[model samples]
Target chain A: MTRLNTLLLLALAVTVPLSLLAGRVWIDPFDPALPNAAVIFAELRLPRAVLALLLGAGLGAAGATMQGYLRNPLADPGLFGIAPGAALGAVLSFWTGWAASGWALPLFALIGAAGAMALLGAIAGRGGGVLLFTLAGMMIASLAGALMSLAISLSPTPFAMSEIVTWLMGALVDRGWADVWIAAPLTLLGLAVLLRAGRSLDALTLGEVAARSLGIDPRRLQLLMIAGVGLTVGAGVAVAGIIGFVGLMVPHFVRPFTDRRPSSLIVPSALAGALLLLVADCLCRVLPLAGGELRLGIALSLLGAPFFLHLLLRLRRELA
Target chain B: MIKQSNPTPSVRVERSRETGARRVSTTLDTNGGLECAGVVLKARLADVTASLKPGEVTAICGPNGAGKSSLLAVLAGLLASDSGAVSLDGQPLNQLPAPKRAQAIGFLPQSAEVAWDISVETLAALGRLPWRTSAAEDAAAVQGALAALQLESLRDRPVSQLSGGERARALLARVLAGEPRWLLADEPLANLDLAHQLALLARLRELARRRGLGVVLVLHDLAQAMNHADRVLVLDLGAVVADGPPEMVLTADLISVVWGVPARWLGEPGARALLPG
Candidate 1:
């Protein structure tokens, strides 16, 4: 069963890239009459595909890391307020006119994510359990959301609110290589941190006392996990807005494949997430929707909400 | 009556006064033994002083807030002591690095809820974390532990799908895979059925006798403790009231005074029991 899951994941890895490369709308390479197609392929579609892969991988890995660290399958970057924090930061950047400057949105997003995580850590305190941390995270997320709403409400220009709303809803439409470049390095760094944390995470599955008995310092690990999640989710939101459900869904989808080990779940979830996002993007392109340009976040959430509800019901049953 | 045997001949003993804590010399008697003096445990754990010998299963018994878990935590090295010291083989336990200490000590908490839904074999493999063993060796250890626990049939099943008793056995397999010299289990028998409880106790006793492993268990059931434990360390309100053989430790006065419950010891030598008054 495990080998079959691995083979399935490998197949998905191969096919996702091929599908990304083979789009239905073919671009003519050297036709002066079709420069627009060349530009779309070179500048928009290619970068969007790459960004989708990177963002998906980052969020999935981040989700796995969060679940392991918190010792709860329900844990995700969004649940911990990292995504909303990043969105708030990006909105602040745009409202302050910093979006005119290169990389400013990402910078602000990173700062916001780090700040929210720090606040969460403070509220949770040393030796505090997951309940405390989750409560703190929920509080911070609500505070950030309220502030974001206020920012949108008080915007002087009509374009500001529309831009804020668009960003909040998340879109990968106009993302180019620059956004990809900015997110890629940070995502890779986050992945590295989480992968190195695999052994500790496994130890943690037995609870803090057991992990401590295994020579793991849970407090230090929690801090590291928070920082890693912050970096990945912050960078992702900066590039793609508040893309929901990927962080929550990807790890769970790939868990059975990894035999449910945190060590194996990290990388596979990343690959699975990248594939899911790429497929969703492709569907957005081909679907005959009225908007023609479907919001990636909306499409993902529409598919992911039921899955999330199912998981919640399963967890409830298990607990019962 | 079985008397305490002489310390093992192969073991080495040393005493150091550099930390201003009482030093207990290590001696490897036929049975693995542990000695602690002036040991100041974690911030919450009160000062504790005790000695334990192998060939005997000792149960550390106390009320909910009696620092029983904290003491176990200290002995397991999960929490570092603030003042006193613990020693194994006369070497200071606090002085060793965390992983090295873990190799010598196996700990099982009252309730261990695994976060992931991993297969039993993979979960057992985690026990070899402190060892520099190869993947094949780790696999062998996992298999051995599973077989010992009679969990071979359930090795491929996810722990989440297992029953409560099965989950406990699987975790026991994980701890056994570590092959620690000393076993410190905190309320391990809680939530288990009568059959599983008896089975677990029997397994622990077998391990202690066959491998000469020092077994320290924290139990709430005075009756079970008296029935299975060779020695009983009774704690009340964070202080040891009695530390001796089960018959002597489970006396009526101590039981009533420490537990605030009326109980009596029944039966003759070799088949003694605790009965509710």
Candidate 2:
């Protein structure tokens, strides 16, 4: 476990500097002729890099926890509907022209996330099993997704419609230190919560009844999962729109290196997740697309969908 | 004819005092292994009352839908009975903290599943979840458990790669790592071959005798119960029909009345087989 952590941390150290340097401006530290290089580094790249680390780490840890809870390697935090719910909240802010006011967009998204979490908890009820929880989350995701579509169709103006669409695609363009401040603590807090659930998640690997007999309180675990996924995903949607797949893919990448225990997967997954988003975001900046920079969310999905397909095929082979 | 063993509290007290002085420090309670009074779980279990003692292998035997598993679950504190109470070592089970209760009682479900591709050692180490002990302590316990199950060679192997008997042993090793005073299992031998079943039963009997563990198993094979278990508790529907030494309690008449099968025991004592007509 320590070896994996050390390796990932070393990789992160290398990638962070590269990510900051490899962007559109490409500021060389040795060059004396460059103007506003420090400004570009301080004001623009640093916060974005920090934001990537925070959100990616949060997403990765969340994915590991989710997979552990469901006992399915393919399980993703998005299965809980918190991200979609947060996106719906953000979409409403734009639809009603309230996003023009500072903080209203994030506030609305967080509210939406809270609503989804509350609904999930209520529907799951007491002594509810993982299957029941998954079904409830799927229902909430579908409901939120439909509501988001309705909001898009009823946009106040074409510009508002376009803005909402663009934001929904998810990016880190023009994100400032304010966004970093917003995500830092919430993501950290979310990671802490997910890590706290790690031992219980490991117990769950023996199935529900065995886990309970091992002192795992199902209701308490459910609460931790909801809160942790809610904070991380909701905070990401609030700042960077709807970035996806970091949570889904990072755990898979790190699983082979660890002991395959749920608790052991969390930290390494987080570090790898941070590395993945930073590298992906840097790639989006330099990819030379004709229609401006590609959205981070779209970029990940482009990479993620194929990865997902490969995973499914491999699973089929294993089962066969 | 069935012979009922009378409860002798004074004799049991004196025996407990002697055993308590000789028992390992990890054994949490010196008295009252596990007791359920008037436990009722809707239609599944009805007003079941029994007291199980440590250092004995007690087989809970009954036909399908006869509430054997339910009684075991209640004893393990996994299922709350509708109206009765399950106590461990004279303490009301539900009132105790879950971690403390877990430290004392290890339960293996009927079809325990390993959800991840974790190593056998890792899976066995999961029993230390309640203790959260030092790494050295955890490793030692896991090692002991693996050794007991004859899984030391397979410790590094993944659980998915294990054979049926090996897998069952690995799952039981997880329960053993906790060093629980009570070990309760539901149909633990159902999926194993005859040889594996006999091997596993021998290990359980040894643990009960050597470590003073209270071993309660819901068994479907009557002959196995008759041969391996020191005491047998026979259930009909949801109540205890017979509870005593297996030789006395598992009479041919009790078998016919409970199972609706005219089964007869053949072969000498300790090597008998059931022949059903």
Error at A209, model 1, angstroms: 1.9
For model 1, the stretches where C-alpha displacement exceeds 4 angstroms are: A1-25, A28-37, A121-129, A316-320, B1-33, B40-46
lDDT tens digits, residue span A208-246, model 1: 778777777666777777777877888899888888889
Question: Each predicted complex: what DockQ?
Answer: 0.66, 0.71
Q: Model 2 segments beyond 4 Å from truth?
A: B1-31
For model 2, what is the alpha-carbon lDDT of residue A70? 95
Q: Per-residue lDDT of B87-161 in model 2, one digit per residue for the tens?
A: 888788999999999999999998759999999999999999999689999999999999999999999999999
Q: How much is the lDDT of residue B66 in candidate 1?
A: 72
Q: How many residue pairs clash (N, CA or C atoms closer than 3 angstroms) in each of the candidate models, in the order given? A: 4, 0
Tell me the TM-score of model 1. Answer: 0.88
Q: Give the TM-score of candidate 2.
A: 0.95
Q: Second chain only: TM-score per model? A: 0.86, 0.89
Which numbered prediction scores highest in lDDT against the true structure?
A: 2
Query: What part of the reference interface contacts, as a 0 to 1 fraction, does candidate 2 reproduce?
Result: 0.84
